[model samples]
Target: MTDLERDHSEPPDCLSIVSQVTNSTRAGKRERLAGAAVRVLHEQGVEKTTLADIARAADVPVGNVYYYFKTKDQLIEAAIEAHGHHLQTMLDELGRLAEPQDRLKALLRGWIGERDLTAQYGCPTGTLASELDKRDDGLDRAIAKVMGRLLAWVEEQFAAMGRTDAKELAVALFASYQGVALLTNTFRDPDLMATEGARLERWIDSLT
Candidate 1:
């Protein structure tokens, strides 16, 4: 029988109890698994991390992981989505500031300040996107959508500065940020990001 049919075959009262217990257990297990996956990805990166590693780190059976997440990519995608949402919220808060330049400055500062974490794990979404590019098209598209939103916001900031080619300028700024972030990750020093970020900000100020 199909999984859904099997699920529905249970007695109504038994099914209700099973559903509650299953949901509660699944919630706790998902949290642990997701947390373990994040730690593994942060430490070993998405390319090197394995299902066995995640299962061991989470103290769950390898089979149990499949019960929660259908595949490793699903787990990674969920983690990426969570991290992206966090960054989106932070960017939205920065976007709410009175002045566009101030908002841009805040973004720069925040980006540079992330060196503490980025120095170790790199940019979560960026790293995940790089790995996803090698694997699933759907995951890659989802990550691209998130990045597109950020790029659009940056373009809006550039437009506010009266830059005619806001889209191109925004792409340039993002490329610079990504390059510096990758460098910082490789070198294990936040200073590279700080130095380049300062230069970029100065250049932006000159444009205004």
Candidate 2:
């Protein structure tokens, strides 16, 4: 599939793993597993994380996982898909703001949850792609779509601001985010995330 097609496409659900989340007839164990997988994948690199770890985190029997996911790869793929769902929710919420500047600020504001958690784990949406890229195994593309769409959304905000280099601005803005996240995670300094978030908000205000 083309890059555009890939971006627009719904990632494989790994046998409807997500749909099962809302099926009241079931115990919602699948939802818990998917949520736990996201948490495990974020807190630990994909290469080091095991299905057993995820099972333990979800409090599901290790053997039960195979009923939902035949392999760890399927679980990971589904977890990455779950991230897309989460990112869309953020975008939808940010869309509620009226002005482009407010929408952009809202985007940054959305990142301010559980500071020490972010300091310890880094930005979940951004860091997962970075972690997978380390493997060079080509699985990073799934997560990269989420990042691409995020940058595209930010670029739209800058373009609305009449910035000719809107795309470049988007790149720089996102780079600042990742850089701050790296520093926060490295130093375990929760303040770094807040400080950088404030700086970005002010910088947005400074734009002509």
- Using TM-score as the measure, the top candidate is 2
Which residue pairs in model 1 clash with each other?
Answer: none
Candidate 1 is scored at a TM of 0.78
Q: After superposition, how far is residue 117 of candidate 1 from its true place, in Å?
A: 2.5
Give the range where candidate 2 is weakest over 10 consecutive residues by summed lDDT: 4-13
Compared with the true structure, all predictions reach lDDT values of 0.79, 0.81
Best by lDDT: 2
Measured on C-alpha atoms, candidate 1 has an lDDT of: 0.79
TM-scores for every predicted model: 0.78, 0.84
Residues 102-153, candidate 1: write the lDDT tens digits: 8888899988888878888787767776877887458788778788888899
Model 1 has a clash total of 0
